[model samples]
Target: MADLAMPEIALLGTSADPPTLGHQALLEGLLQHFGQVATWASDNPMKRHGAALDQRCELLKTLVESIADPRLQLAQDLSSPFAIATLERAKQRWPDRRLCFVVGSDLARQIPSWKDAQRLLEQCVLVIVSREGWPLEQADLQILRRIGASPRMLPMSVPGTASSQVRRRQTTEQLPKCLLPLVLKHNLYGFNTTNP
Candidate 1:
């Protein structure tokens, strides 16, 4: 069990194929709600990624750097496809602080089915950030609680800019300006130097 008296650190892991403005907004919002926020880019294991893990990490690092907040850290060491494994690693790194695993509302329904879901819930508080299109349902929250999770809703709205749209349309409008040069240099997500 985490120490409630300790400061809470938000752990956010995502498949940042090409980090978008939405990701930046989410990170900023998390910083407002928590004392510290640790974010990383990792393979989701369930979905296919356009860029390699290292490339995604670079993009995420750029996004974190752009935020220019000391409280927001790009902790790639905690990157893991399994949330339980990430939480365990985080516990080792910050044993004195309470860990709050951050996930978007789109992923809320899949929590109960995750590996070692019960144990993961027991170790950290689950903080769900509401995405623009994906609404958080009461039934999903109930299911998470039934499976031993104490979930809290983050009172912030995430921009609707999704990486999928960027990849499918091969557009750079959704991407952060800092990532544009990297994306063009690497030719990631089928985007080339021709794109502005």
Candidate 2:
């Protein structure tokens, strides 16, 4: 019963346009670090991704289901422009859990400019997934530290795979294992199931 009361949660929010190997590694790593992993498919106002909001959310749900890891769970897209808003909602839902927000190094650097950035940083633990090509420099790391964000790093050799690259080259390139089926069936990322 003690386990039920322990607060351990981590949020891995992304567009997850189709999800990828990088996303998988990050989620798996988060699963190990926390009692529950909330994978959110958010729609960023800044960019138009491969899929729409609901489509991306559905893809996330599908990918999570395929992995079948009990530790990994899906969170609502919330359609909130601000990460702070989503964090607030996440806090309300998991009132008993210690919330941690996971971001890649690039996003980590951009956090300072996000809406209510400081509040978002203060709301929960910041977990940074330092990917292969985009290593976090000490200077940037210091910047985050200066902002009162002592982020924990989830180190892994995730290749420099971007969702944009996938969408652009979907016609000729190979799809990630987990996303292939959904991409094929739903014609996502402009993937042509016939040749794939």
Candidate that scores best on lDDT: 1
- TM-score, one value per model: 0.98, 0.88
- For residues 85-122, could you state the per-residue lDDT of candidate 2 as single tens digits? 99888877877887778788777678887888877777
lDDT tens digits by residue: candidate 1, 1-196: 7778999999999999778888989999999999999999999978999999999999999999999999999999998999999998999999999999999999999989899999999999999999999999999999999989889898998988899999999988899999998898888988776765
Enumerate residue pairs that collide in model 2: none
RMSD of 1: 0.8
Compute the lDDT of residue 137 as modeled in candidate 1: 95
